[model samples]
Target: MASRRTALRPPLVSEPDLPDIVSPAAPRRSSDLRAAIIEVDGEADLAHSTLEQCVLSGSGSALDLDGATMMDVDVRDLRVAKVSARRSTLRRVRISGGRLGTLDLSDSGVHELELRDVRIDYLTLAGCKAVDVRVDSCRIAALDMPGATLSRVAFAATSSDEVDPRGMRAEHLDLRGLDALGFLDVTALRGATLTLRQVELLAPVFATAAGILISD
Candidate 1:
């Protein structure tokens, strides 16, 4: 059972209610735009603003944002055709309903990221780093964090199909209700610690590390 606060799903910004993403006479930066709904037909620069329940799209890209702030956006519903953002921060961002696909956060950065009630696949956090992260009620099919830092993270009731925990340090990487997690590159799990299920799943590898043979 969900709490009452989460039950009241907010309404999305309507197309007509949104403003033109880019205008010839439009303000130069996001700080210049004060309207709630914005629509653009070409590339535009968006710096700092409170964009709520609005749609930012363009033929090339409704909006070309460099440093923007978003909250509870319907990004998870955009699937693979969603907009691209850089140097932005997200909070309470949910990708639970979206079809799990490659999430490119290679060079991007964030303060806090939340993944809940979503489906994900092939998430690439190559160089992305976050101080705080929360993952709940989501299904992660394949996760690749070659050079990423996920400190003070919390994960509950999530499914990890293929996980590379090498070079990834988590004060606590909670995996209470998970089934299987793949091991790749073989170096990611160098210093990773696992619970009972994780140990059972990776027993062969552990045995090899200890020079003990349980099965011939």
Candidate 2:
């Protein structure tokens, strides 16, 4: 072996491929579920699919199903300019966080019509029938659900300022945290009953809205 002088060795070179940079955020509903039909409820088995012409908002609300992730998976909100559910089935659907400029849920059936954490401007539910519905923590200026049969409807912490609740009916009306129920016609609650606290809270506003005077 020839006498090898200690020579300075060059550093070894290493190479690695780079990964494609993609957004960490989840895919959009229009893109991810383009072909997949999703249910509103958190169930293991889904029976319905193919929700064409349906719009789902991508925001979860406080009034949502328990133990369900409304933020990512509970994406069944329709942000359409005008919604026409003429012959659609929206059962067990947890819809929240969207603007339904005008909604016509007529003749359509709703098993669990959950509208939690939504921003509803004007909604019309004429001839629309639903059961077991809840609208909690929502802000609505006006909502019309006339001619619609509702069973066990609970509206908790919802605000319907300047809304017409005259003819609106609910089996168990939970208007505890509501601010305004004055814009509605008092005749609407003719056949319905209310609680003492609700009556007390609404008395002044009711009298004021009707141009009446309330004294001690």
Candidate 3:
């Protein structure tokens, strides 16, 4: 006789009533001028600058754009080992290619920042506040967002191996097209909205985190 497979029962705990999530607003084009090319090896500050088809190349602590604001910029490649923009802001900025070792935007405020077709080894947005942030068609090895606050953030057609969201707060977090393999801590997703498939995929991890045992 063949053994029968048992179906896993739904959790007995009632689902929390969550409000509707909002999508991030897309960035608006700021200018009709040609983009400027900036290729530097050390720390540079660019304020009220519009760059297009720019390529930044350097090593650790090589680029810092603190208190700088960029609009209508299209950065094609970033080859820096580590880039930090703690207090800078960007609008209608696009990053298309190149591999970044670490990109840190901690304690910064940003609106309408878009990252597409890029590869980041480690991304840190700790203690930062952002709105209308979009990441699409990218591969991130690890993401750290401790103590961060975000609104209307969306991740689409992206793959992240590990995400660490401890002490994070978010509103309207859209992960509809995310292909996440590992979440370092699922407890950080308390106030985030996910699709049905995402919930199904992460149910086991959530159960383990809640100390729920499944018996056959």
lDDT of each: 0.51, 0.48, 0.66
Q: Where is model 3 more than 4 Å wrong at Cα?
A: 1-35, 41-61
Q: Which numbered prediction scores highest in lDDT against the true structure?
A: 3
Per-candidate TM-scores read: 0.60, 0.56, 0.73
Compare candidates 2 and 3 on TM-score and give the better one: 3
lDDT tens digits by residue: candidate 1, 1-216: 113243222112222233455233342366543334343435545555555444432233334444566554334343442234455655434443555355555545654566667676666666666555666677778776766665545566877777765566433344444455666543454333346777786778767666888865
lDDT against true structure, model 2: 0.48
Candidate 2 lDDT over 1-216, as tens digits, reads 111242322212111111233222322322322223333322121112233223333322211221121111233454544444453455555666766555556556666566778777766665556666667788877777665555555566788766555445544334444556554565455333456777886677668767998787
Q: Which of candidates 1 and 2 reaches a greater TM-score?
A: 1
Model 1 misses residue 100 by how many Å?
Answer: 4.1
What pairs collide in candidate 2? Answer: 40-93, 55-78, 56-77, 57-77, 166-188
In model 2, the worst 10-residue window by lDDT is: 63-72
Superposed Cα deviation of residue 72, candidate 2 (Å): 15
Report the error of model 1 at residue 124, Å: 1.4
